[model samples]
Target: MAERSEEVKLLGMWASPFSRRVEIALTLKGVPYEFSEQDIANKSPLLLQSNPVHKKIPVLLHSGKPISESLVILEYIDDTWQNNPILPQDPYDRATARFWGRFVDEQIYVTAMKVVGKVGEEKDAAVEATRDLLKLLEKELVGKKFLGGERLGFVDIVATLVAFWLMRTEEVVGVKVVPVEMFPEIHRWVKNLLDVDVIKKCIPPEDEHLNYIRARMDRLKLKSV
Candidate 1:
């Protein structure tokens, strides 16, 4: 694998699932980087400078040039390493993998968040929609060990929400958003994904994440009231 002597830094918030995706990818690829914690509420000049458009938590700085957005960062890291390839080699297979990765973000994660953020009928609708989306993903993973198949790849990395975020969100909301029996494939995939050393190590501390979600839930409740 090629090595870069230029500095690599990750500007991120500790409890951010998006940031976790990039950290996990870099770790898997054996890329060395400095992690600078960003207080997103009190955004630093550097953070603002790095991602002026979105002002997002994760901004991967490669030799001072910034790459914003988690999914894009994952692809960039995979392209840089080329050893522990995340995306598929074949063009069609690569496109398929990218599609699922996008689905996890655009469809699954976004809808699942609504299940917790909303209340009563709205929350119920969001939960049902999320379930239907998961059903599609489960079928997609019918005979596969991972979404990327046989190993943790781009899609598996994108699923940091299932492996880490969802549980904390469920705990705070006082609902089992994704019941294990109902989504057995997702549960199994999450288990396998977390078993990987890089993924496991990149996960934020449970208590910290739990507290963060609890605070967010409290705010959501206040908003509803």
Candidate 2:
């Protein structure tokens, strides 16, 4: 096995769920990389230069070549490090994994963003839409341990990240979209995800995240008022 180059670096935000996805992938693959924390509000020069298009964190720099976008970076990581592969080997399984991953990116991500940023009827609609999506996810996870089955695969990582953010957004909006009783499967999945050693270490402290969301909600309320 070829040793991964030491020059790989990850530019990421501390509290970003997107960045957490990349971090988990790297850890699961046992790929060593330097982590540079970025303040998205301040917009560090390196982050801006590395990701000129999106100016986002979770940028992967492999041997000086930067790759932006969390999903794109996950593909790059899987391709670069074949060991502890995140995607399935079979063609059909890989495709299925990709489909669920895209679903999280489109439906879950969009609804969670709306719930956190908007208010009034718009926010209510977004919350209800998110609840419906979570119900769908609960049904999908009925008998499966993870989105990609027993092992935590690519889709599981993407979905977990979205779920993490949605849970936080619920705190911010003073609403509960993914109530444990209503979505037992999702609740089980959340426990399974956090039980992983790497994920357990990577997730932000609960109180810290709650405080951050509360402050954000306060700011949003003030702006609206």
Clashes of each: 0, 0
Estimate candidate 1's alpha-carbon lDDT, on a 0 to 1 scale.
0.85
> TM-score of every model?
0.94, 0.92
In the range 4-71, model 1's lDDT, one tens digit per residue, is 72478999988888998898888888888899999977999999999999988799998789999998
lDDT of 1 at 181: 89
What would the TM-score be for candidate 1 when compared with the true structure? Answer: 0.94
lDDT of 2: 0.82
Model 2 residue 112 CA deviation in Å: 2.1
Give candidate 2's TM-score. Answer: 0.92
Model 2, 24-56: lDDT tens per residue?
898898878899999877999999999999898
